[model samples]
Target: MLQYQTIPVTPFQQNCSLVWCDQTRSAAVIDPGGDLPRILAEVKRLDLKLEQIWLTHAHIDHAGGTAELARQLSLPIIGPHKGDQFWIDGLAQQGKMFGFPHAEVFTPTRWLVDGDTVTIGNSTLQVRHCPGHTPGHVVFYSAEAKRAFVGDVLFAGSIGRTDFPQGDHDALIASIRERLWPMGSDTVFVPGHGPESTFGRERRSNPYVADGV
Candidate 1:
């Protein structure tokens, strides 16, 4: 099984997850936004060797700290697909607009697509390109743990915002219903912000994408 910790980082309180394998002690930090110090501290506290960084999307609040963390640890960054390249390229502008400093842009070592798998130690996460939030958003799902790190995708009682550039509300809904719903209702998901929820609960009560909504 994969062991994980969720660290809410940035002024936005984006959930930065530290997922590792119990057997290997190797880990991957997912979506390090602004609070690099806290993230590094937690890594040390858990005694995990940083292997790589994984991103769900390139939104400023979710990916702002990726560059610095990657540089400091010499770990490769992966995911968010290639379509969100525009957002990655505009990291500086996003920082300026959001008043977040050091939103440096860096290329991903691997651009994920649907049906790809990412490994961390002995555990592996299946990648699903669930765009609409950013046109390239991906959700990391671990079958063994029945947990998903769904950044800015489906929330407890809401869904991701689709007002940003390249965002599609219809696409977002479809991704949630088709890609996420099939993961099984008991699967617990970690959103970019806010508390985690089960896929079943959201399917039943989420106003935006509920079965009866």
Candidate 2:
């Protein structure tokens, strides 16, 4: 079975996730956006082997600690698509602007695209390129867990801000309606910030992208 824990990090309070397969105890940390001590402590407490670092996008709040974490653990980095290369390159500048710790930029070991799958121990997760918030933005979906880690795409009652460089409001909406909605309303999603919400609930109540909107 696959299980995950969310740890909010950085001033942005990005929802960094620690996902692991219980049977094999293999784990991966998704979006280590600072607060490395806290993230590492949790991994230590769980006694799981942390093998990979997965990213959803390259925003400072979502990927601030990626390079450092990967170097420290000798772990491979994956996902977030190649479209986010520029954002990844600007990590240092982003950190300075955001008043975050010095963030180092690094290349992903595997750049993900729609339909790619990532594995952890005996469990596997489907990856989807649901851009808009950022051109390279992606989401991780665990079929068995019925959960989606959707970065800054869609929130509980709101959606991601498309005001940043390369952000596209129309594209975001289309990604939600076309790519995410098909995942089933029952699948709960963990956003980049705030609380988690189900697609069904968001579809019914989200002011921005409700069914009728």
Candidate 3:
């Protein structure tokens, strides 16, 4: 079975998930926003062999601790290929723009693309290129687990802001409806922030998904 734990990090309380296979103890870290100590602690407690660090997107709150943690764990940083290269390169500047403390950037070892498969332990997470929140935003879906790690795309009762430099409201809506909604209403959705929700719940209640009033 695939087991998982979420560690909320940074001032934004971004959800950093540590997912592992019970049989092999091989693990992957998703969205290590910050709180390096806590993430390391969880890895130690779970006795997991960290193999990869996955970022849902390049936003500071989502990818903040990536460089540090990847360096410390000697793990590869993996992300989708569609996000703004400028945003990834200018992480420090992005932080300053948001009044956040300066942070450094880490080049990803692997650039994910749509339909790419990221292997962890005995399972594989399919990459869905669901842009909108950012130019290269994506969600990692595990067919075996029936769960998706949707980063800042669709939140509980609400949705991600589309005012960021490369954000697009129409595109985000299209991505969610076409790519995410098709995952089926029952799929468990692990968002970047806030509580866990199911695709069905959001589909029925999310204002963005609701039919025109």
Give lDDT per model, in order. 0.93, 0.95, 0.85
Cα lDDT, model 2, residue 93: 99
Over the stretch 1-213, how does candidate 1's per-residue lDDT look in tens digits? Answer: 799999998889999999999999999999999799999899999999989999999999899999998998899999889989999999999999888986888999999999999999999999999989999999999999999999998888988999999999999999999899989999999999999999999878888888942
Model 2 alpha-carbon miss at residue 104, Å: 0.7
Alpha-carbon shift of residue 120 in model 1 (angstroms): 0.6
Taking all chains together, each candidate's TM-score versus the true structure is 0.98, 0.98, 0.95
User: For model 2, how does the per-residue alpha-carbon lDDT over 95-139 read when each residue is reduced to its tens digit?
Assistant: 889899999989999999999999999999999998899999999
Q: How many collisions per candidate? A: 0, 0, 3
lDDT of 1: 0.93
* lDDT ranking, best first: 2, 1, 3
What digit string (tens of lDDT, one per residue) describes model 3 on residues 150-172?
A: 98999888888899898999999
Residue range with the least summed lDDT across 10 consecutive positions in model 3: 204-213
Highest lDDT model number:
2
Candidates 1 and 2 compared: the better one by lDDT is 2
